[model samples]
Target: MTRVLRLAVSLALLLLAWEGLVLMTGVPHFILPAPHRIAAAFAARFDLLAAHAVITATEILLGLVLGVSAGGLLALTLTASRRVRGWLLPLVIASQAIPVFAIAPLLVLWLGYGLASKVAMAALIIFFPVTVALFEGLRRTDTGWIDLARTMTAGGNAAGWRVMLYLRLPAALPAFGAGLRVAAAVTPIGAVIGEWVGSSGGLGYLMLHANARMQVDLMFAALLVLAVMALALYLAVDRLLNRVLPWAADTTIPATSR
Candidate 1:
């Protein structure tokens, strides 16, 4: 409750500042709509905004599921096979070198201006951090635990699998949780960018259309809704991670003590 109050207070202060800036600067409404103008726009176009919000949210959720699954599977594969890791790790690293914005249009072209393209964009954005964090965690699992797993299992390739599944995966859950939090925060970027590149419906599409028409208040409303959605997604992910990996929550230490 206290945290919620603090957040609300901060947001209120920001809106107050924004409105004050507009009033003090005597800016045109088309150039910078005040908070009340945005609120009025939001109230007037609530239904339209709601529909686009649903489409964007669906894209983000689907992309998150696909991205996490692909990332986890690839991390497992890399951990299980050194040869595969040697061949694929460089490719994975190289993929990130190209800007995601550069690929949005290509994705829209290939996947069409549909949900698929937006989901793919979101998945692409989410894939790297998850893969890297989990893979690193798996690789850095304590040798002592592996030795223990080895002693408990029959001596064979099966024993290594056992060690990986039983020891390393559990140890790496915190890292996976961290990756998930990051993915959640950025998932909207991919979907929105894809929509901006080409889309029939979405908050990004609405914003773009509003901007072109000089409906600044409507654009600001869409922007505010998108920001709220992103924040909610991130907070939901954080709460889930806390539930699933409670140990991580209590692991933080004071900086002064350190």
Candidate 2:
């Protein structure tokens, strides 16, 4: 609750600062609209923005579901074999090295301006962190447990299912949570990037349309919506983690651990 208050205060201050800057700068509304002006834009153009927002939200939700599932399955495979982990790890890392900006256009070209392209872009961004996080957790599985199982003449599958899956994976929740947080943050950016390249709708496309007509207030309003969505996603993920990993529910996370 204290942390929630802190976040609320910080966000309030951020908006205050943003509005103050615009007021002090004496910039034209077309160039840099104040928050009140942005509010007006949101009120006036809400229907349109809401429709686009729904589209983006759908794409983001589908992409996250698909990406996390794929990553988790791949991580399980990586857990089963060092040879596969060694071969695939570099490829995963190398994929991240290529800027999304460079790949987004190709996705647009190949998949065209549709929900598929948007979902693909978001999934591509989300998959790597989850895969890497899970792989790392798998590698760091409890060695003592593995040894004990071996001593008892336990089979590989039984030991893994009994001990590794239940125990080590739970231990790795904090790390996996870190990656999930990253994925949550990146989803909006990835979705927006894809929309910027080709989509007819979404906040990114709306911003483009508004900017072309010198409707800075509308652009600002769209941006605020994007920020809010990202914040909501992060919070939802945090809450889900705490619920699913109840042992971690009472623990205070270190700031740097995120």
Candidate 3:
């Protein structure tokens, strides 16, 4: 089956199971509304959902752009300069030691309860993976390639920069693509956490209000929307990476009976 068809079938099965369990258990709607109830809530408040979704989407996109750019630059810097790496690498590693949730409040306080805070949160979350992946890729460039480049530029003063630009950068694309996929997957968590901590808009804010009002169905609808958004973003990024980095083909081995 096609991917879309498989996804549809899976969703249908899950909804059926969920509805069946609720019906059999006689659970209260507030506790766990039936799928139909959630659907009703979704349709009823689509306008509200759409408005908040746009804000969240904007934050995620902006964050992704900023994160990828900064991460790529940092990775290049770390690879190119040992002195700088010694100073910056530890700080980068230390930053990840703190939980993102604990940092959300501080980000809100610093950047304020606006788009800035959300964007920063998402970028901060995305930074480490991208930096590490690209740095390792750069560092692990084939020694044979480096030797060839050095021989070619035996008398040139700019040999290092030339090799970095022509050889190392190309080799690192696959690793950077891998890190980008991860960054895209986790992009939503940062924005939503920022919203949950302090925000006037976005799906997280909507869900928070819905829960406070005991609108369980509406809350579920918002959560569903967030899931769909995250899935769509990740798929889009994956497809883009596959197209852009055509040489980085998947090499996963299929399972077979012995």
User: TM-score: which candidate is best?
Assistant: 3
RMSD of 1: 2.8
Q: Which runs in model 3 stand beyond 4 Å of their true positions?
A: 250-258
Ranked by lDDT, the better of candidates 1 and 2 is 1
How well is each residue in 123-188 modelled by candidate 3, as lDDT tens digits? 989989999999998998867778878788888675677788989998788888889999999989
**Total colliding residue pairs, candidate 3:** 0
Per-prediction backbone clash count: 0, 0, 0
TM-score of 3: 0.94
lDDT of 2 at 203: 85
User: Model 3: C-alpha RMSD to truth?
Assistant: 3.7
For candidate 1, write residues 7-26 as lDDT tens digits: 99998999999999999999
Can you tell me which runs of candidate 1 are displaced by over 4 Å?
Answer: 154-158, 250-258
The per-model lDDT (C-alpha) reads 0.91, 0.83, 0.91
